[model samples]
Target: MKIRILRVFAAVLLLSFALPSVAQNVRYEQQGTAYVTAEDQWIADRLVDQAIGAPQGADAQVVFYRTHDQVPGPVRVDGGAGPLALLESGTCVALRLVPGSHAFVIDGRTVTVRVEPGERDYVRITSAPTGPKVAISNALTFLRLVTGKRDPLYASN
Candidate 1:
């Protein structure tokens, strides 16, 4: 009886280890202009798997490519909104991520976005204020003003 029980346990362990290999793999596809926002933001994301919530491990990262040309410092993500991290680039931001919807706020500009597994979503953010003006402004003050603005894209959700 003891031998029989041990065999059953070993089989169960083997099956547990094997099952994950049968699980689905993430697939990516390049979306045409179909996914772009009304503001002309082009978004590229994965097609495989339902929306991932969060990934495990420290190596998982979300990279933000900011084509907007401004790298906001001391960036932060709203924890209540979703799981996301912020990385700085000269013009792009990289995020260490899981999968799911996220709100990316930089230089006080917020983009409410979603991510898929095994895919890099490239978006051209279009809500930026136009007409560049040269003026001396406090970085802290600017940060406060921009961050304080409740993101319309996020607030409605």
Candidate 2:
């Protein structure tokens, strides 16, 4: 019994030290504007950087996709969650999205796509002149963009 107890203690000690590295998991999900305040954007950006291996104070990958409808029309698509990989807030989680099609609505169209971990993906905004742009904001600006209502980055003086 004493030997078994000692082995369990050693295993606990090993896990205690191993947990921090395991905490590095990334949770990726599309943040709903309704549920997220502007400040959350900063947090989201930070999480994205960490997901792509940038971690805090480092740069990461961010990409955007635009699409024009085969025929002229409003760009519309429904995009929120999918089977693709995503890193999200609340929990530092790393997992593949649910295995299936997810709808993304933007502009005025609809798109069905799959999402997974590390699969940086986006809804194709067809028939739109421009799609959402993804840019890296330094820590300060990133915070301001989230906390401030007006986009200081694009405000006209």
Candidate 3:
């Protein structure tokens, strides 16, 4: 009986560590864009109503790409009326924003983007000589390489 209890306790402890990793893997799919986690989806939905509220046709689209670098830390997004979402290198997140100007604070740097209806915008976060920087670009080629044949919004942690 004591051995059984010990085994159960061990299992519970092991699960506690494993559960966080599992939760991190849960991807929120929306309109061919994928949020890294359910919380990310919820926060984005709240900040930009069109993200998941509309069946189709977002007011605007924004893609954030975390460039591959030697940096070992995750970049976090702040401001823009949404909760923070941590981004790791080699991963990207696409956001649907309401038509307007929104500023996002990433890695302690501010990136302001103007969203126009029916427009697709892209931002890349890279390690710059000064530090981390966000730049606007046409990410079609990069997206194609990372997304492949899979749904444009599909992502896995």
Q: Indicate which candidate wins on lDDT.
A: 3
For model 3, the stretches where C-alpha displacement exceeds 4 angstroms are: 1-55, 128-130, 144-157
**Error in Å for residue 147 of model 1:** 31
Tens digits of per-residue lDDT for model 2 on 1-157? 9999999999999999988656532211243343344445445555555644332222222232332234343222234643332222111122233445555444433455554433433322223245432222333343343344444432111
Q: How accurate is candidate 3 locally (lDDT)?
A: 0.65
Error of 2 at 102 (Å): 1.5
Per-residue alpha-carbon lDDT of model 3 for 1-157, expressed as tens digits?
Answer: 9999999999999999999777655423332233344444444343333432332365687777787777877888776576556778777777777878889988778999887886666678886556688887554434443545322443332
Candidate 1, run of 10 with poorest lDDT: 41-50
Backbone clash total for model 2 is 31
TM-score winner between 1 and 2, please give it.
1
Residue ranges of candidate 1 with Cα displaced over 4 Å: 1-61, 68-89, 125-157
Estimate the TM-score of every prediction. Answer: 0.29, 0.23, 0.52
Better of 1 and 3 by TM-score: 3
Ranking by TM-score: 3, 1, 2
> Could you give me the TM-score of model 3 versus the true structure?
0.52
Q: Candidate 2, after superposition: displacement of residue 59 in Å?
A: 18
